[model samples]
Every structure is written in structure tokens, then in C-alpha cells.
Target: MLSKRIISCLDVRNGKLAKSVKFVDTIDIGDPVVQAKKYYEEGLDELVFYDITASSDKRDIMLDVVSSVAEQVFIPFSVGGGLRTVEDCSRVLLAGAEKINVNSAAVRRPELIREAADAFGSQAVVLSMDVLRVEPRPGLENGYEIVIEGGRRRMGIDAIEWAKRGEELGAGELVINSIDADGTKEGYELTLTRMISEAVSIPIIASGGGGTPEHLYDVLTEGKADAALVASMLHYDEYSIDEIKDYLIGRGLKIRKA
Candidate 1:
């Protein structure tokens, strides 16, 4: 079995890294370039940098910051936020992102997914879904809607169906971020994560609410996730990357131990 990956996320806003609960109540953390360097030195499997407000604010991702961090980190890095056009995708790729994550833009123009995959191959594109469970609309049976626009807009789309569609559209992987569970550290949304994992052949990275090493264990072992994306725990110094890897290794999960 391939070793499960421990990825540290850097949420950048105005060139500064930040974190929030359920995608709101934002607090500044620090410079993303510094944080990226720190995680790389800590021996993390990969790094994810999100221009957290870019999509919602309708602006381009910070290329200067992206370039700076990309220059510093040796590990594979994935970048997201406000990437809407083929040119937008190319700019970031040239700036040094190994993979480009598209969220609201993809939903708005799924052709962008196909275009990106055609231009850069599916392996270079990651479709990120910021999902929240909402009451089924009138005339619909019991079901939840997939919210978008950084979790602020309701799209009336089913989350499971969306994942399937993303796979069909040639998305190499999916990052399912649970808005309800984000930053709570309670745990990942296992049911949703498992459902998406089983529904799609591509790897799924489970995000949100990972507060403990056990949370990571449960998500990989039971939730059926390919990897776990952690932010607050690692950012606050609650746990080190080596410590998390050791715990997963002790639990019989495959992980690279340094």
C-alpha cells in the first residue's frame, strides 16, 4: 500500500497566512513564504497554498507570494484561488505550482476543467469542493446541497453527484473540504468523505476538523481518504509533522518516517 500523506495547508490572504472556523472569522497567521519553508524543512509529504479569499473576492491569486514560496520549497506544491481561465492556470504553473486547484471557477465553467486537463494533463489539475450540508430544497427529497463561492453561495447541487461529475470531467483528484467540520478539530466528515472516495476512482484528500492524530488515523483508516490536509493543528504548534507521522506509523498505517 502506498503511504498515506500528511499535508500542511497554508491559507493566504493579502500575502499573509490566515485561518478561520467554517471559512469565517479569519485571523492572520504569518507570511506564507516563511510558513512554506518551515513545513518543507519539517519533512512534510506535500504543501497546499490557498489564496483563501481570492475566489470570493473575485481577484487573481498572489503570484508574487506564490513565486516566492515556490522558489523556497522543494516538495510538490498545489495552489488554488481565483484561477478561472487557461491563462490564469498557465501563469501559476509558470510561477511554479506543481498542481493548480480550481473550485468555484470549475463549477461555473466545467469546460475549464477539460481545458486544463487537455493543456496540462489531468495530473496537473485538482478540483477543490468546499461543501456544506443544507436542507433539501422544496420538491426535493431528503438531501443536502453543495455550497460554493467559498462556502457563502448555495448552488443547489448535490455533493456526491458533483464529485462523480468532477471525475468524469477528468479531474485528477478531489479535495473535499467540509465547511461544518473545518477548524473544529472534532474530526473529518467521515460519511461524506467515504461516499466521495467510493464514488470516484481518483484520490481524495480529506480536509477540515482534524484536531488530533487520532482524527487523522480515523480519516485514513475508516473514512477511506487518500490523505489528510491539516492547518490549525500544525500552525498552532499543537503537533509536529514527525509526531503525526510516527502516530500513523504506530497505528499500522503506511507513512514515511524520518
Candidate 2:
């Protein structure tokens, strides 16, 4: 089996690292560059830097911050938010991000995914979906709807269908971010994770609600996720990358050693 990945997430808003609950009530944590360097030195497998407010604020990502983090961390990383076109993807890749993730923009114009894949290869494009669980209704299969613009707007699109479409459009990977489970620290939305993982063959990185090593283990094994995207647990110093990796390794999950 391929080794499961543990990814550290840096959510930036207005040039500072921040964390939020259910995509609101964001609080600034610290400098992203410093944090990125710390994780890199600690031997994180990968990193994901999101310009949190870029989509909601309708502004481009802070390229300077992306460059700073990229320079500090040599491991492969991805950048997301406010990436609306192929030109934007070029700018981010030129700035040193190995992958470009599209959320709000991709939902608005899915061809952007094809365009990005064509220009930079599917491996360079990642489709990020912000999803929330709602009461089961007649038509909203799985009862999860896709939200965009930093979870400020609900697109009313079925989450599973969107994931399959994203893959068809050549997105090499998908980040299934569970808004309700985000920052809760209970665990990943396993049902949602498993459902999507079974639906798409492309690697899916389970994001949100990872609190303990067990949570990571469950997501990768029982939940069938390819990776776990951790934020609060790592951002708040609740655990280090090595600690998490050690636990996963101890639990029989393959992980890269520092």
C-alpha cells in the first residue's frame, strides 16, 4: 500500500496565519513563514497554504507570503484561494507552489480545472471543496452541499457529484474540507470522507476535525483517505508533525521518517 501522508495546513488571512471554526470566527495565530519553517524542520510530509480571505474579499492571494513560505519550506506544498484563471495558476507556480488549488473559482467555472490541467498538468491542479452536512432531503444525495467563498455562500451542489466532476475535469487530487467538522477536534467526518473516497479514484485528502493521532489513523484507514490535513492540532502546538507521524506509524500506517 502507498504510504499515507500527513499534511500541515497554514490558513492565512491578511498576511497572518489564522484558524477558524466552521469557516468563521477566524483568529490570527502567527507568522506563516515562521510556522512553515518550523514544520519543515520538524519533517512534515507536505504543506498546504491557503489565503483564507482571498476568495471572500475578492482579491488575489498574498504572493509575498506564498513566496516566503515556499522559500522557508522545501517540501512540496500547495497554494489556494482567489485563483480564477490559468494566469493566476502560472503566477502561483512561478512563486514556488508545487500545486494550485481552486475552490470558489472552480465552482464558478469548472472549465478552469480543465484549463489548469492542460496548462500545468493534472498533478499541478487540486480541486478543493468546502462541504457542510445538512438534513437529508429528497434530492440532495448524501445531504452535503458545496460551499464556496470561504464558506460564506452555499452553491447547493451535491458534494459527491462535484467530486466526480472535478476528477473528470482532470483535477489530480481533491481536498474534502468538512466545514462543520473543521476546528472541532472531534474527528474527521468519516461518513463523508468514506463516501467521497469510495466515489472517486483520485487521491482525497481529508481536511478538518483531526485532533488526535487516532483521528488521523481512522481517517486514513477506516475512512479510506489518502491523507489527513491538520490545522488546529498542529497550529496550537497540541501536537507536532513527528508526534503524529510516530503515532500513525505505530498504528501500522506507513509514514515518512524525519
Candidate 3:
């Protein structure tokens, strides 16, 4: 099997790293730059920096923060939140971000994905999906739907169809973030992750609800995810990147040495 990645996630709100449970009750954590440096030194595979309020606030991403974090981490990291146009994508990439993720904006205008891919290659564009389990639609293949704008609005878009469409629109990767599972820390929404993974040919990074090494294993293996995006587990200092990598390796999962 290919080596599964362990990506550290930093959700920035008001220029500080924060954590939220089910998209509410957010708590400030720390400076993202500091955390990024710490995780980089610990040998994290990659990092995902998100301006949590950028989309809802209707403003550009914190490019200064993105640049700071990029300077600290040598590993390829992705930046998301509030990125709309190809110009926005260019700005983030120029700020040292390896990949630009479009969530709400992409849902609103899918051509942005194609434009970004055409301007900066498919590998440089990421489709960051904020998904939630909803009432089953009669014609939909899955019970899940796509939610955007910091999980405050329901798009009524079928998650399965959206994933397929994202790939077709030139998104090189998909970050499947489960809103219901966010900050729960019990485990991931494995069924939801698996559903999207099976529907897309691109790599899928399972995000939200990662609290333990066992949870990571389940999502990466049984859930068929290409990578596991972790927030609470690493942010709270419950485990280090080395520890998570060691645990996964001990469990026979092919992981990059930390």
C-alpha cells in the first residue's frame, strides 16, 4: 500500500489558531505560525491552514499568516478559506502555499476550479468539502449533503455527485471534512469518508473527528482515505506527529517516518 499521510490542520480565526465543535463554540488555540513550526520540526507530512472566518466574513485570506506558516514548514502545505477567483489562487500560491483549496466559492462557481487548474495545474488546486449528514434525497446516492460558509448554510448539493464533479472540474485532491464529526474527537465519519473515497479517483484527505491513532487507522484503511487531516489530536498536544506515525507504522500502515 502507498504511505498514508498525516496532515496537521490549523483553523485560523481572527489571526489565531482555533478549534470548534460541530462548527460552533470555537475556542482560540494559539498562534498558527508557532504551531506550524512546531509540527514541521516534529516531521509532519503536510499542513493545511484555513482562515476559518474568511468565507463567512467575505474577505480575502490572511496571506501574511499563510506566508508565515509556509516559511516555517518545508513540507507541502495547502491553504483554504475565502479563496474565490484564479487571482486569489495565485496570491495564495505566491505567498508560498503549495495548494489552494476552494470550498464555498467552488460550490458557487465550479469554473473557478477549472480556471485555477488551468492556471496552476491540477495538483495545485484542492476541493475542500465541508459535508454533513442530512435527510436522504430520493434520487441521491448518499444521505450526506454539502455544507459551506463555515457550515452555517446547507447547499442541498449531493455529496457524492459533488465529489465526482469536483474531480471532473480539475480538482487534483479532495479534503472531505465531516461537519458532524468536527471536534467530536471520538472518531471520523467513516461511512461518509468511504463513500466519497469510492466515488473519486483523486486522493481524498479525511478530515474532522480525528482524536486517536486508532481513529486514524480506521479512516485511512477501512474508510479508504488517502490521508488523514487532524486538528484536535495534534493541536491539543495529546500526541505528537512522531507518536502518531509510530503508532500507525506499528499497526502495519505504511507511513512516512517522522
Candidate 4:
């Protein structure tokens, strides 16, 4: 089996690292560059940097921060937030990110996904979906709906359908971030994770609610995720990348070691 990846996430607000629970009550943590460097030294497989407020705030991502983190981390770096057009994607790539994650903009104009994929290749494009669990309804399927702009707006699009569409539109990978489970750290939304992972052909990175190494194990196995994005567990010094990898390795999961 291919080695499962442990990814560290840096959610930036005004160039500062921040964390939120259920997509609300965000608090500034620390300098993202510092965290990025620390994670790189500790052996993280990949890093995802998101300018969390850029979309709703209607502004550009802090390229300076992106450059700073890029310089500090040698692993695969994925960036999202405030990327609207193919030109914007280019600017981010030129700034140093190995992958560009498109969320709100892509939902607003899915053609942007194809355009970005064509311009930078599908491997360079990642479609990030901010999803929430809602009551089952006629227009929505599986009780999972698409929420955007920091989970402030409900797009009314079905999560699974969107994931499939994103893959068909040429996204090389998908970051399925569960808003309800985000920062709770109890566990990943395994039912939702498994559903989307099975629906798509590309790799799925399970995000939100990862509090322990066991959570990572569950997501990669039962959830069928290719990678797990961790924030709160690592952000609060609750766990280290090496420690988590060791746990997964002991649990019989093939994990990339530091």
C-alpha cells in the first residue's frame, strides 16, 4: 500500500496563524512561518496554507506570508483563499506553492477549475470543499451541503456531486474540510470522508476533527482517505508529527516517517 501522508495546516488571517472551531470564534495563534519551519524540521509530508478571510474580505492573499512559509518548508506546499482566476493561480505558483487550492471561486465559476488545470496541469490544482452536515432535504443529498467563504455561505450544492464534478473538471486532488468537525478534534467525519473518497478517483485529504493519532488511523482506513490534514492537534502542541506517525505505524498503517 502507498504510504499515508500527515499534513499540517496553517490557516492565516491577516498573515497570522489562526484556528477556529466549527468555522467560528477564530483566534490568532502565532507566526505561520515559524510553525512551517518547525513542522518541516519535524518531518511533515505536506503543508496547506489558507488565507481564511481573503474570500469574504475581498482581497488578495498575503503573498509575503506564502513566500515566507514556502522558504521555510521543503515539503509539498498547497495554498488556498483569494485565488479567483488563472492569473491569480499563476501568481501563487510563482510565489512558490506546489499546489493551488481553489474553493469559493471555483464554486462560483467551476470553469475556473478547468482553466486552472489547463494552465498549470491537474496535478497543480486542488479543489477544496468546505462542507457542513444539514438535515436531509430534496435539493441536497446525503445531508452534506457545500458551504463557502469560511463556512459563512451555503451554496446549496450537494457535497458528493460537487466532489465528482470537481474531479471531472480536472482537479487532481480534493481537500474535504468538514466544518462541523473542524477543530473539534474528536475525530474526522468518517462517514462523509469515506463517501467522498469513494466517489472520486483522485486522492482525498480528510480535514477537520483530528484530535489523536487514532483519528488519523480511522480516517485513512475506515474513512478511506489518502491523506489527513491536522491543525488543532498540532497547533496546541497536543501531538507531534513523529509521534502521530509512530502511532499509525504501530497500528499497521503505512505512514511516511520523519
Model 4 gets an lDDT of 0.90
**Which candidate achieves the best lDDT against the true structure?**
4
Q: Write the per-residue lDDT of candidate 4 for residues 1-258, one digit (tens) a residue.
A: 689999988888888889877776889999989989999999999999888764444334468887877777788998888888998889888888999999999999999999999999999999999999999899895999999878999999999999999999999999999998887879999999999999999999999999999999999999999999999889899888889999999999888776
Ranking by lDDT: 4, 2, 3, 1
Model 3 segments more than 4 A misplaced: 54-61
Q: Candidate 3: how large is its RMSD?
A: 1.8
lDDT, residue 94, candidate 3: 93
Cα error of candidate 4 at position 200, Å: 1.0
For residues 23-56, what per-residue lDDT tens digits would candidate 2 score against the true structure? Answer: 7688888998898999899988899988876454
* Candidate 3 C-alpha lDDT tens digits along 1-258: 578999988888867888777776888988889988998888898999888764444344478888887776789998888788898889889999999989999999999999999999999999999998887867455899898877999988899899999999999999999998888898999999998899889999999999999999999999999999998888888998888999999999999985
- The pairs that clash in candidate 4 are none
C-alpha TM-score for every candidate: 0.94, 0.95, 0.95, 0.95
Tens digits of per-residue lDDT, candidate 1, 1-258, equal 688988888888877889877776889978889989988998898888888664444334478887887888898888888888988889888899899999999988888998999999999999999888666666322254577776899787888888888888889999999988987899998988998899899999999999999999999979999999999999999999988999999989999764
Cα deviation at 188, candidate 1, in Å, is 0.3
For TM-score, candidate 1 versus 2, the one ahead is 2
How many clashing residue pairs appear in each of the predictions shown?
0, 0, 0, 0
Give me candidate 1's TM-score against the actual structure.
0.94
